[model samples]
Target: MAGRKRNSAEDIVRKLRRADELTAAGKTQEEIAGELEVSAATLYNWRRQYDGMDTDAAKELKELREQNGKLKRLLADAELEKDALREGSEGKILSPADKRRAVDMLVTTMRVSKRLACRAVGLARSTYARTPIAQTPADPDAALRTILRDYARTHPLHGFRRAWAHLRHDQAIAVNKKKVHRLWKEEGLQVRIYHPRKRGGVSSCPQTEADAPNVVWAMDFQFDSTVDGKAVKIASMIDEHTRLSLMNIVERSIPAQRLVEEIGKTFALWGGPPLVLRMDNGPEFISSALQQFCANRVGISYIAPGTPWNNGHIESFNNRLRKECLNRNHWTSLLEARVVIEDFKDDHNHRHRHSSLGYLTPAEYAAPCTHTHQPVDGREID
Candidate 1:
């Protein structure tokens, strides 16, 4: 059996016009249907549907229908794009893994097609379809990561380079520093860096550069309080060349005499006084007692009254003490503060890796210096 032919809007309109002309020419409906080669039912149905419509009107209707369909398709695409963007807005979709996750979310939750999800997330379909390679059981970085995690736990204040130094030197693990840095970031062990505000104006006082151990010693004071609110004063002195913390004196208050005595004790314990003592113009440092003590034993290089940068070595040490020790521990009594502070000073000398010292501890760096003197016993104070 032959199937009936489907006519478009324009063809139907032309056929209907022809049928009307034939009807006006005294032709029967059956003849018109025969002439048009359509069934009587089809011709009747076309007339009923396209009644009172011209060919131009039918063409306009067809155009309108096509335009409407195109608009609907465009709107759907737009909606899919909007949904994909919203899904990826939680954070930056920087990595391929992140984009894959976004595509999966859109496909699963929004019921969108994989193609559309990939397009919306700015990922290629092939990339989205690709599977990630799995890691093997014998990972090279496993041991390094374990060591790094332990180092990070113990020294929360140290950065990746310091950790690398500890691994290479202390642990005898020969790994690249860059590899350590990458693992450090992956393990979330990177320390937050503090950026100091830039200040203008140079100090009038000339700075002294230390070329050898025991050449220049910098001394400074830091203040804190016990839990009961009694004031705790700290006096820190360090060898500028070797970066060794010579002494840290913690007490309720240190007058000129006490300060002079502590300096004398530090000098005797460390095998002698430095040639030059770098300090700020504090009352305890500038008093006649301290001035006379320095005049006989060491020369005083007082920085400009307000410029602490002239004594930057001791200032940096104080900052580390405050950050790593004092800020982390709260002391209920003066004795506890002294004990904890002493332990920190010893750790800094023997264990802390200094970047300027090529990641070596101060004690280790000073050990090779010929001018460095050996310390005597009975150095502990009550």
Candidate 2:
């Protein structure tokens, strides 16, 4: 009915840049022409026109514009937060949903990017990034999702496997398990997350004696990014015996050498390296630098890959840290991330109660005095 859509002016400009890049990469003229849907002669002309000039200047300029937009949004969000804090100081709690609605209004009316909209409203980018559930006409699988949800509501115990079987048997439909499973997961019908554990294998054996402090330290890496998309690599080491957070190291990138340096610092602080350092088989943990660093000083015990529960202490800490500190807050700079994360670590150590330690905070559990560690006058602080 319609001919192929003609290349727009902006599209032609983009293709010219791409043509130059393809030419530089030693690709044939015909290849670039076909990929860009232009004649080879056109590509040749584009090269003659753009080769001598800095074609990337256009792209860089566009990127700079985008960066400037984001920075403006950051400023707006900062102002919103300032006002919010002033309101909070007057005993008025800020309503997040109201703020989110205002961002949505701006996004709809102004056609602004969701990232910018969220930043302008002082909302976490992660919240804006969440996939919204809506009953809509454009959704092809709306009826199916509704039916599956109704089925799940009726039978709470049934997983996607059973859901698939029920659909085929009761509705007389032909469908595969994979499609059903994907829909089930995306619809949030799957309630429980079951982790598989090796039953009786020797390698699956759980350690028994983390009885005293400085016996075993669990290590893991928590990754995040600054608002401008700079990587924030956080290396966390926690004493398994005492549930004490040993160190939380934040950097742009943490290689094996960096990991070793953090471990060495912790070792010096804690009197010496623990007998065992429990870790996952991550690249940095298994590298030669880390292996050599741990040699004769601390025993390296790598958990089976995919089983994070083997380092359960640190994994648990990651959940709390990411939820309470990382996800909710914006780290505009590396220093802010470092400072805020360290503060969260301090709060976790001194205030947060651990069920493993009889509901005592890590600081109290690790304390030397039994009387102070125990509830005073048989009354718990909580």
Candidate 3:
């Protein structure tokens, strides 16, 4: 036989809490009894159960009931949001008609009033009722938008005028070109114009004008071949500010050590190393000897490889040297190569008008720095 039930103080408090929740859910007495595993009489008796519980416990129960009410309202709002929103199609926003239909659905299915449903869905009452005429005609370009997408997919390079021609006569669609043009712009469809490729590697560092002669030096190497098939390697240095050629050394194999020696000679001739040395990542320029040579005397600024434009001063000079000196002559011996190259270098510093220096020769621009003695055809200044 089952013993008679004993309702402890804690059990009474828990039953009373469950009873209030069941009441809010609209459960009948018998349903509450089944869920609580108690007789219907017990639920009626536990109505005054919180009176025996402590004040803190009673306060906590009251807070929980308030929180439950808020949760129910939130759940209801989330369900309506899911039903109200729809993914935009063909790049069009949800139309007024679409929103109005959603509002009507919420009112019917959720049993909410029209005003409340409209507020819940974030739609203004005026906007939901716009275009009140029930017999408004459908969009004339509804089919045109679909046709334009298909046509552009097939002929991507053709513009709106070409597509309009095809539809007017080729397929006998009988649509006005004006309507097609309007739809084309509204749909954001167009022919893709091609852009040309940019040349050279882009400069990566911030740069400023070289304010004084020998303040910055641009170094690079050029290669050519003698008539007997022996290779010629020439290293050249130009003043970044003045565009003056500081040194031009020609050798069969230009090593890092040899290049460093040439640079040291420039320091001796020009008083000291320049503030910044701009060069490419060529082995000779980036080697340990060159790195230490510039350590205290000059800062090395390495340009991004494949971007000759970064060291544009030397690059422009090398181009001219190649065109005016290398390509113009056939070298038979290294002695002739050195002598002829020296003469060409002198002529450039003395006569070649640099566009960047206001069409002034590199020699004239550099004259302010070399105040010692006379300049011999711009070659013996430094």
Candidate 4:
């Protein structure tokens, strides 16, 4: 039906053009109309119709021709554009089957093939195949902080693969495996050193003291050797209740006189002599002067021997000292080492945290300042 309408419109245009040509050749409208076998009114109508013909069918035909020309040009342009896109992606060596397989794999696994990926990324085949991806640069300070913190908290999965997984899931860092591996290696984020393995079950100190701070004191010594074959021992005393190291001193040896002096000094600084003085089975701790000082002079009872584990406070401090200070430095001289040790002790006591002491420093722990010994006679002190 549409085709028939178009054909009728074309016939009208042709007849109108012929009528115009006759009028232009000096034939009157009446003669032109009479030749066409119409009445005088119809003849005037034909002239009017011919005059108005230019406004409708002719105009519409001209517009359609212009539109048809535009559509042809646009079709040519579209073909050229397709050719350009195909040319840009044509270096792939993949067969038709391979291409289909590659596309399917990419959609399924969300991974593209080497050749197709190179094309998709607008890189040369050789360049994409050989060139390594830029590894994500991890902040060294952040990784180190994580290592130390996790080690302290005894996190089960404390190394890089686990850490990277954590970074991906918790922190939303979308890093690829190879890139993460490279950065992990470059940053030395893996756990290279392991905790010294023990044969039996780990030993823990059982709390056996009154609730107050100064009721029980634990003392121990750490030995550090000088380059000249001279050994220095650091005698440290800590309050069991508060986990506060009351005394820390580096000496040539753990002498009985020196130990006595240190115990006196600790008592002078922070009053209230401990009721029970805990000691390991070391010779320095068992010295006559140390025994006398605790027994007769200080009037403090001694905890059982051969059990340094009873001195948990000082042992914990020793672990911290080893990790934060001794492990981090290599000292040349005894005096240099002593100064460093003193500085670390001061820092630990005044600044660093004690987890068992509610993350407070030793000074903060010591601030409460009172000890009420629970009498064993089923009675409490007022």
Best by TM-score: 1
lDDT of 4 by residue, 1-382 (tens): 4342232344545555676788899998778767755456754644554446654765676678779999998786556444433544446644333344343444345343444444443446655343233233554446544543454354332455555554554456666656666555544456555555433432243334647877777777787766676777787777777766678788776678877887888888987587667666777777787777766444343344544444556777787677667766666787888799888778667765545655466677778757576756653221
Q: Residue-wise lDDT of candidate 2 within 181-257, one digit each (tens)?
A: 97887777877645555454343544534667877788899899999988899999898877889998999988889
Cα lDDT of candidate 4 equals 0.61
Candidate 2 — which residues are off by over 4 angstroms? Answer: 1-208, 369-382
Q: What digit string (tens of lDDT, one per residue) describes model 1 on residues 279-345?
A: 8888898899987887767878888876776778998899889988988888999999999999999
Ranked candidates (TM-score, high to low): 1, 4, 2, 3
Model 3 TM-score (2 dp): 0.44
Q: Supply the global lDDT for candidate 3.
A: 0.74
Error of 2 at 144 (Å): 47
**Per-model TM against the reference:** 0.73, 0.45, 0.44, 0.47
TM-score of 1: 0.73
> Candidate 4: misplaced stretches above 4 Å?
1-207, 296-306, 369-371, 375-382
lDDT of 2 at 265: 86
How many residue-pair clashes does candidate 3 contain? 1
lDDT of the candidates, in the order given: 0.85, 0.74, 0.74, 0.61
Error of 2 at 281 (Å): 0.6
* Candidate 1 Cα lDDT to native: 0.85
- Winner on TM-score between 1 and 4 is 1
